[model samples]
Target: MAEKLSSSPPARNIFQRLPLLGTGGVVLTMAIAVMGIVQGLRTISPWLRIGNNQAKAEISTLVVQQIRAVSELTTTIFAMETVVPTSQERQWGNFTLGRTDLLYIGYGEVRAGIDLAEINEQSIQQQGETLIVTLPPPQILDQKIDVERSRIYHYDRGFLNLGPDTVPELQTLAQRQTLAKITAAACDQGILNQANQKAEVALASLLKNTGHRQVEIKTTNPTVCAIPSAQGLSRDKING
Candidate 1:
């Protein structure tokens, strides 16, 4: 009738008419997601910091242990070199031969007494200055031998007798004994000198190996110092 009132389709619902409401809901979801991510990062940050601190402490402890170990090794080596003799001297033999006249022919033999004296460790320590070592006292070994002989010879109606003669033998023996004594003395002196040189070398090597150097302390309350690195500060090097 009245031109059918020219009616359009029934009015749309508010939910369908306002498309921006859907967009607003999507924005709110995105904001919530961003907030969740930020919270997760905050929760993990403290654990990462704690792990980093623990690693740094372990590294410092290891360095200190290495230094102490090296020091102890150096000390032990020095003691050994100072206390032990590099060379030793020993008496080999001593003997005498003689002829005597008791029967048709006779022979006698005599052996010289040997006395060995070793330089004590105390003496070595007193002479040395580089290191201290404990050493036992010197010991002496002695040996001696004695013999007698007589000989007689008969020719026609006369008898000839012989006795031991030891003057020339004693002179030669004395010369050999003096040479041996000189050799022993020389050996002792040489060994002591070698010990001192060895100690010097050990000390030098220890210093070099340990990188012995003066370090300036940056803080005293917590005992902190700057660690030298090829590239400025340690933090900068690590971060870069």
Candidate 2:
């Protein structure tokens, strides 16, 4: 009966009380800890996402620079032979004074391609893992007559030298005409289309080789083929 002799033992410390927490209590404690860690992560997730997006943006910029470094890409070549008949006539008021006739057999080439230097950051876009590149329109890059392969097949002064002695002039005219004709023919034969197709294929291969697994190439319609003519030459100067 001295001080009622209390039967209750001393209170357990946190470490000692942990063992009294049975399966359900232990599970609840773990859940609470997990939730706290998740909350901490959530607090910093926005910055993490921003950093990831920034890294991707930088990579896309570098890719754009790499593409623009390719400069000009020649994709297709059109070569053919043409026969051009050019003539000149001088008239004196209801009477033909003189005439010159020249037959030219010319071999020419037309080059069609894209100028990659025109590519800019705007031309390229990235979506997840794929890249979309919009290329410049295909155009006539170069056209020329092969001087060594071209020649004046025939020259006629027309009726006892009544025509002007303009061998060199007529040859020059024929060459200019040859270039125009070949360029027109090339355009008619789908040179621009060929350039576009080949360019797409070539770039796809190039991008794939550079570690791009998915790439889409887009092209623009070609401009009209230009027919070159002498600046001051008149219709009267060219009879044919």
Candidate 3:
């Protein structure tokens, strides 16, 4: 005898019915890959943040350098030489070494200018849009003897040259004297005045970048910015 079939369908494992080779399977795999990438980014988030902050700090430092324009301005205006006579004699034990006579032509360079670096918080005052800066006094920045440009026009070593060769000493003395003379001459010729005027112009231009439409430069106590006096020696004696 034959039996009648039931109307309901048979049940199966859910895993067995899942799509394995079609678009649905591919979509699920892609979703999992996206989730993995997101997790990786989260793990390195702190390191990425540190890198970004460091880059920003470096850029800010560069910006400051560009803004502090001409904080120190130096001027080399005059380079010249003078011819002078100098002599030196040395004594060792009981014997006089020997004397040296030198006619030295030395190149003297005068470095005179105002240092804007001297500008302090007190030096600069703001009144509305104008900037008032009290500049330091103009003075001789430096006095140098150019060895390469200098030469001994004449050198005389005493008879038989008993003393240690004093040519170098005489040369050095001549250079020292020449520099003093140059400084005095520059002062007489108004080098300091010129430097002060130039400072005003240069600093005004530099401060323009600092957002100040107007800059007023004034000098502090005007000092006796002349070369300190030293006895000028001639033929081993003070030139009276």
Candidate 4:
């Protein structure tokens, strides 16, 4: 019997080792791909952070612009004049004259009459609102006086007369009427001034209130990022 050579361990072949080597290589490649992905994420984080900061800055700028716009609108409204009629002609009624045979009676009747006192009084109750003065109906003041009378007759039937005995009373009434008109005008002016002051005060109060509310919102409910940035994560890790 021929002595059989101990069979050497089956020679390892490149083909047989290929699958193992390829698997190892694939694992290494996967590790490198993972590392590259991590690096890419690290690099993009800073750009994302910059973009977020820019967005925040843009939002802050828009907020400021809106606030300025509101402020400007408030100021314009405050400076605007009320539409109330200030002219005397528009406030007062029309005047008419009638002549009689013996005496001429000049009657001043206002088509519309405005009572400033009433307006002012109403303003006391309704603050911060404009009040318009409206005139009432025209008041009639009649004056009759004799024009010509004959003296030849003992009982002089014809005589120059101005009007009835109430002519003096009418004159006095006219004076009072004129004075009242002047007083009303002054009162109206005062009321308008007071209303404007109140409006300004209200506007200031509104601005202050709005600012305080915004501050409270900022302090009590602070904004926080839902997902922390990579930089923030690095900072936390370093701190830890």
- Whole-model lDDT values for every prediction: 0.31, 0.79, 0.68, 0.30
Q: What is candidate 3's lDDT per residue for 1-240, written digit by digit as tens?
A: 123233222333444556454668789899999999999999988877765445444533443343245555565366778997987677787767787688999886787887655655556566666767777888777676677778899987768865356776777678768878888888877787888888778767766765656767776544786674444423322221
Highest TM-score: give the candidate number. Answer: 2
Cα miss at 125, model 2 (Å)? 1.7
Model 1 residue runs over 4 Å out of place are 1-19, 40-48, 51-53, 65-240
lDDT of 2 at 131: 82
True-vs-predicted CA distance for residue 41, candidate 2, Å: 8.5
Instruction: Give the distance in Å from residue 123's predicted Cα in candidate 1 to where it truly belongs.
Output: 36
| Candidate 4: tens digits of C-alpha lDDT, residues 122-213 | 12111122212121211111111111211111111122432133433333333333323433333333433333344344434433433223
Which RMSD does model 3 reach against the true structure? 12.2
Q: What is the C-alpha RMSD of each candidate to the true structure, in Å?
A: 23.7, 7.2, 12.2, 26.6
Question: TM-scores across all candidates?
Answer: 0.25, 0.73, 0.59, 0.27
Ranking by TM-score: 2, 3, 4, 1
Candidate numbers, best lDDT first, in rank order: 2, 3, 1, 4
Q: List, in order, the clash count of every candidate structure.
A: 8, 1, 1, 17
Which lDDT value does model 4 have at 193? 38
The candidate that wins on lDDT is 2
Clashes of 2: 1
Off by over 4 Å in 3: 1-71, 89-99, 158-165, 226-240
What value does the lDDT take at residue 42 in candidate 3? 100
TM-score of 2: 0.73
